[model samples]
Target: MTKFKKRPSKLKKFLGLLGPGLVTGASDDDPSGIATYSQAGAQFGLATLWLALLTFPLMAAIQGMCARIGLVTSQGLTVTLKNHYSKPLLYIMLLFSFPAITLNIGADIQGMGAVAHMIIPAIPVSVFCVAFTAILMFIIIKYPYQKIAKILKWLCLSLLLYMIVPFMIKQDWVLVVKNTFIPTIHFNKEFFSIVVAILGTTISPYLFFWQATMEVENMAQSKRKIIVNKRVLGDMRTDVNTGMVLSNLVMFFIILTTGSVLYNSGIRQIDTVDQAAKALEPLTGKLTYLIFAIGVLGTGLLAIPVLAGSQSYMLAETFGWEAGLDKKFPQAKAFYISIIISLLVGLSLDFLGISPIKALLFTAITYGLTAPILIAIILHIGNNKEIMGENTNSKFSNVLGFITLFIMTVAAVALIYFLFK
Candidate 1:
């Protein structure tokens, strides 16, 4: 007699739906992003909270297109770009991406180090940075893709602390709700710069690369030669949507918590995660500070790997070296080396005497400058029939993609104007 196969339970199935999208989304809230969002909250109050809502659809569309590209083509974005675009253009894009990603990694490692030092005063920040770099490199080199993804997914739970913190403090629900739904525009230079930073950090370039490659990784894990089935596509949509929602929800709460506590308490500037945490102690108690610190550390762990990995993947693909987190160190020496170099360079930034929060903000500004160029390329690829085939972006996707591009372009132009003026 033939035996019946056991079906997965609802919870099991729901968990199964998550993959690269979830991990990518979680990584989006990295230390730098936390710094940017926290700065926005502390500096501007609830005026910027609506950005979390506004960016959700735009981010989902762009990332969904990226996921579709990987699933359909069975390649990372860099490989696809190399195949279609000129060698000169590819090199130029890589040149822009490398430094931006490097600065981001450096800032993130520095942020993590600062937080580590905050938690343990006796240990120096340099030691923590070195330790974090070593620990993350070991995990990426030793763990298989599935295990790494699982660990990252669990780390995302730390962001729930942001959601919980908001409820612990009294809030002006009327003002919060009003500001969240209604857009608030400030013509000031500082506001414009922060808006650009918020947009840049949220819909980041690293995430673009990570999301696409991750879909490719997931396809490999499934042992599928091609992604042609409607069911498979549907599952991907579910995963991407779920991940983006969770990412933005965490962003929303972070802004809300800081706006209610830090901004209201007259702490208008947040130079470190420590300052943000300490300012919360009097208002939300010690637990709030602990949770914020943990959230920053957790997100840093989740994000630094992605930052390093995205660079490795793009470089490996561009240079025709074997790449994938699934491969052993011996099998993918270049890829592994790329990761090590990124982490070490980032770790060194901690000793540069630059303020962690300032470095983090500067990285966001760099991303803001580079992200639009990458987004434009993504849109072009998503709409190219030869590249995406029937999976080409729908009208709705195209509309949202262009809107996102336009918004970023305007922000960039506005930023330049403010700088010159």
Candidate 2:
């Protein structure tokens, strides 16, 4: 009994250190995320699972830089950009990012309503969209930031559902194992398209804004001022590495679960969480369906606030108004108002009768377009000694970061050409 108690106590302490990274990483698998993963599995089978491995280090480096920015400056990305870069550049970047983030929040709320439609079919998605947006607003506007973060942290545990189901489905261990290591590129339009989408989704632009701001939130939680040093850099690295690794692992399982269950059975489309859940039933069993549903609900709860908060942060920072969930609503009226506006905008999109699946994919494509520029800014900021002090990026991290930026930029260009042409 003493041994058991001691181990559980140790686990709790470990988890305490893991809060921000886990919540951010897990939220990466929101309904939009699930849709992306499901589409990859349904369309291409396990071919793209290999890309998750490639993006892990790149994602970690970028996120680690974002965390360090906050720890060093105690300010969010938009604020820092305004101070560090020219105003015209800042506004131009925001022009791309703000609309993308706002649309994404709308898409996420719409996805949540779509999921709710699964649980109660008669209830219209638009009504649930409004209700869900209102509930998230109350939570953010009415509650403490720390409490919201904690709730998201716990809600994040729903990710394990996909992890558990993949194993239970009993896949071709040899093939799954083979695909994990071997990289295959078909080099055709569709293959390149999927590859681009994977990069876009994994290394998203909004995530850059969200991560940097959350770092400020984390610093606020620690009640620490901006103190630049190597130690803070080290801590930021650990936080990001832990988060990115967990995120990629979850990505792996999402692909594996869908590939094993859906692709193997010739199901080529997954439009909603409900479709994915039903598709998982025959291959992975009903228990897995329940697990998938639970994961959806949990991710929805965890991600909606993040979606809203990123938009709020951008809007607040761009205008020079007081912001941060840590500040009381009255103290940060612009911040809270931005959140409400984003919520309403998102809810209205759903009410307009746009298909949730289409909204998610379109939003994802928008992220694809906007992500590379954000990545460039992040890498540039990370290398700045004034901002990072002695905590500037290592040579190795810089090398990988540049490679990621280059690849993503090229992909973004190609995606735009292909889409419009």
Candidate 3:
């Protein structure tokens, strides 16, 4: 008699489920995002810690819908919009998207370079920036999707340092617990601005494009004979939910670390990742500071590719050119060229005299304005029976999607009012 095969362990099954969703969610807490969250914690203390809990469900819901669209349509979101929507509509999105994504890349690169310079004062920030740029470009051009994805997955380990930080220093467990569960709102422009920044940074527009497109790419790279079925969608949800939870947890801990250490130490008005790291060195000691700074560099390594890849994919899809990270340079010349150009442009931002802090703030503003519109579009597509067929969003997804849309729309309006007020 044949022996029965042993089942795979639960932990192995969980690890196998991680993919595009994992990368996409981790990339959300890029250097720029860290700076935004740091600024919130530094300025307002634990007032914003509750946002991490609130955003997880909202973030997971939106990403889950995008992933589903990619699996069902077997096309990038840009291509779907081009095929089904008006030309001007698609172009408008690209116009808004390209600048924000490039600025974000430049900001992340600058943050990483700044933190690296902090670690090794002998090396210049410019040199570190150039070297990191070259290394990332080489990796993207040289490796296939699976290898690069594995590299990113490992890079995610760096974010856990943020979670490890608050434990190193003394934390008021009771106060932390109280602040996390209880929402606090201040009726002022400054407080609202940080709130908007947090919203814009966490619920970014770039991740939307990346999530849908990478889902398509992830499927293409899979060795198994896969089909878009309930199991597949279920796996996608698990991956996305797990990733978003990780992303939000990192955000929570960053705020907690900064809030407990810096705020209590009378430090406020922190700008940029380097500033946050530098402040931590004195207050929380060298070890905590290095961990925080190093996480910035790791996130840059993980995120810049996502930013550059998403931009390149959008351009490729808009123009009807072949594009995939799994494809070689000769196979996808336009796509690879676009990625290279975006990296070069981002690298030039510092040489052109733009500050990383300014880049982060401006990028947040741009996203705050554009993200709601994209959410509206994603919601429309998710619910479109002609497009999604039988896979249209369920009531649970629709409820979360509408809630996200409503909240983001209100934030966008508040942002505009604040900007012009």
Candidate 4:
């Protein structure tokens, strides 16, 4: 009896430690992310594989700052911005984030519908998309935050398909390691677009807002005061670093799996997860289809809510309304409504007859163009000790954060240039 009790206690402690990072990291591999990675693998093979390694530190630094900011201030991103910065900057930042994030949500909803079609061919894709959107919104409104988080956490484990499917395929280890360790690049516009896609996929701005708000939710779950001491900040950094590393590792496997299976076979095109799954068939066998479906379904489950919730957080904070997943819908009506509105708008896009594949690519490029501007705001807020206190970013973190911002901005500009010329 004593041993069993101790075992449960240990398990509970371990589970408690995994909060924002797991949610943020799991959400990172949303449908759009998978598309970006799959496209990279299909179009560029293992040449851009090194981006996964390169994105690690940048993502960690950005998300860790967000988490630290939330812990210190106990506020959402827009709320913090409003309270500390001028309204013009807040409004400008909101303008950039709102459109990019809404587009992302629409893409996720469309992707979810696409996956539903893959799983249940008889069901109309539009119906499934609207139904899925409603069901998710209903769950958020009816369920407690803890329940929602737990459900998403379990769903995230489905992404293990990326980890498992690679082993089932015949991989060229020599070339795989060579491409991973030895960097490769092409100066052409397509190469630049792939770079932009990778940037958009890994360093997404919504994750920053989501991580901060979720950290506050995590603290509320434990009934702990939001603390910004050295110990708390250290723990937050560890969580962010762990999550970022896991995210990039997943990115690595995604490209490796697709590159090894699809690109090596001269299959140069993919749009939806189904296409990617079909591409995986020759090397990974029939089971690969099952793996791909599970990955999409699982990641969609994890990601869509964060997308909705982050939008909810920002809008509520912007208008001075009560917000937080922990709050009951009656108490946070504005917040919940904002979430549903974003979701429904997203769902409606699926019915517009836009190709799911095209939506996926559009989502990546749109977000990529907007991410650098948002990152600059994040860097500014994170470095201000008055807002972050002891959790303020170190000089090293600030430098890395700005470098990431620079790279993203440059890639986005290059993408635009190629689009016209």
The estimated TM-scores of all candidates read 0.97, 0.92, 0.98, 0.93
Q: Rank the candidates by lDDT, best first.
A: 3, 1, 4, 2
Better of 2 and 4 by TM-score: 4
Q: Model 1: what TM-score?
A: 0.97
Error of 1 at 304 (Å): 0.6
Clashing residue pairs, backbone N/CA/C < 3 A, model 1? none
For model 1, give the 10-residue run with minimal summed lDDT.
223-232
lDDT for model 1, on a 0 to 1 scale?
A: 0.87
Residue-level lDDT for 20 in candidate 3: 90
Candidate 1 per-residue C-alpha lDDT over 1-421 given as tens digits, one digit per residue, 9 for 90 to 100: 9999999999999898888888888889988888888888999999998999999998899899899889889899989989999888888878877877888888888888878888898999888888888999899999999899999999989877778888887889999999899999999899999999999888888788888899888888875466466787788888888888988999899899998888888989987666788788888898888889899899999988999999999999999999999999999999999999988887777777766666676777777888788889999999899988888888998999999999998998999899899
Name the best candidate (by lDDT): 3
Better of 1 and 4 by lDDT: 1
Q: Tens digit of lDDT per residue, candidate 4, span 311-387?
A: 77878878889887778988988888888888877777776766666666666776788788778888888877787
**Model 3 — TM-score against the truth?**
0.98
lDDT of 2 at 264: 80
Per-residue lDDT of candidate 2, residues 214-289 (tens digit): 8878877775465657665665666678778877887898888888778888998887667887787777776887
Clashing pairs in 4: none
Q: All candidates' lDDT scores?
A: 0.87, 0.78, 0.91, 0.81
RMSD of 1: 1.4
